[model samples]
Target: MNKIFLFISFALISITTQAQEIKWMSFNEAVKAQKKNKKPIFIDVYTAWCGPCKILDKKTFSNPETAKFINDNYNAVKFDAEGNEEIVFNKMTYKNPGYKPERKNSRNAMHEFTGFLKIQGYPSMVVINNKGQIQKTIVGFKTSEELKKEL
Candidate 1:
């Protein structure tokens, strides 16, 4: 009976921890969720070849405390700045015109959405209000504590 009780307790703890994780969504999904929850959107714009972007993902975003805070407050989005995906935001369609298979791993031309946001560097973090307007843009890498403060 004690063993069974311990197992059940462990299972519940695992579920609770997973629930606190940041649920990363696409830009469109985040926008859709915003309509229902009325929460701001957090976008992390990165490229495949960026070193700081990897650090941000591994060190900052991996922190449970930071993830929980973002999960509770904002709809998170991971945007590939040079990706060839089609994104529709604010009644406009954004695409990558110069995307090629040869440059898929390296830096290709910027996507229309990246230009629309005026992102000048890799690992740019953007905050969009619930009203679908951009609130702020912070470029470069930040620690978990720094990112929490930004949020």
Candidate 2:
């Protein structure tokens, strides 16, 4: 009976931990969701080859408290600055016209959306108000506590 109870406890703990995750959506989806729900959009502009960007994802975004806070306050988006996906924002279509598929994992052409945002570095956090205006742009890596405080 004690062993069964211990197993059940562990299972519940695992479920609780898994539930503390931020619901990340695309930029377009967040915009649409904003029209209905009116939540601020938090966009994580990162590149595949950026070391600090990877650390930001693993350390800051993976934290349970940070995830819960963001999930509650904002619509989160993970945007690849060097990716090939076409994004429509502010009534314009943005694309990485020179993107090379062969160099996807390495450095490639910067997406037009990234340029439109005027992002000069990796691991940039772009915060947009519920009314679709940019509130702030935070550059560089930030800890979970720092990110929470920023928001």
- Mind sharing the TM-score for model 2? 0.89
Candidate 1: which stretches are off by over 4 Å?
Answer: 1-10
Query: For each candidate, what TM-score against the reference?
Result: 0.89, 0.89
Residue 109 of model 2 has an lDDT of 92
lDDT by residue (tens digit), candidate 1, 45-71: 999999999999999888889888899
| RMSD (CA, angstroms), candidate 1 | 2.0
What tens-digit string does per-residue lDDT give for candidate 2 at 1-151?
9999999999999889877877899999998988888989999999989999999989999999999999988999999999998888778898999999999999999999998888989989999998767899999999998887788
The models' CA-based lDDT, in order, is 0.91, 0.91
Report the error of model 1 at residue 49, Å.
Answer: 0.4
lDDT of 2: 0.91
Q: What residue pairs clash in candidate 1, if any at all?
A: none
Model 1: lDDT of residue 13: 100
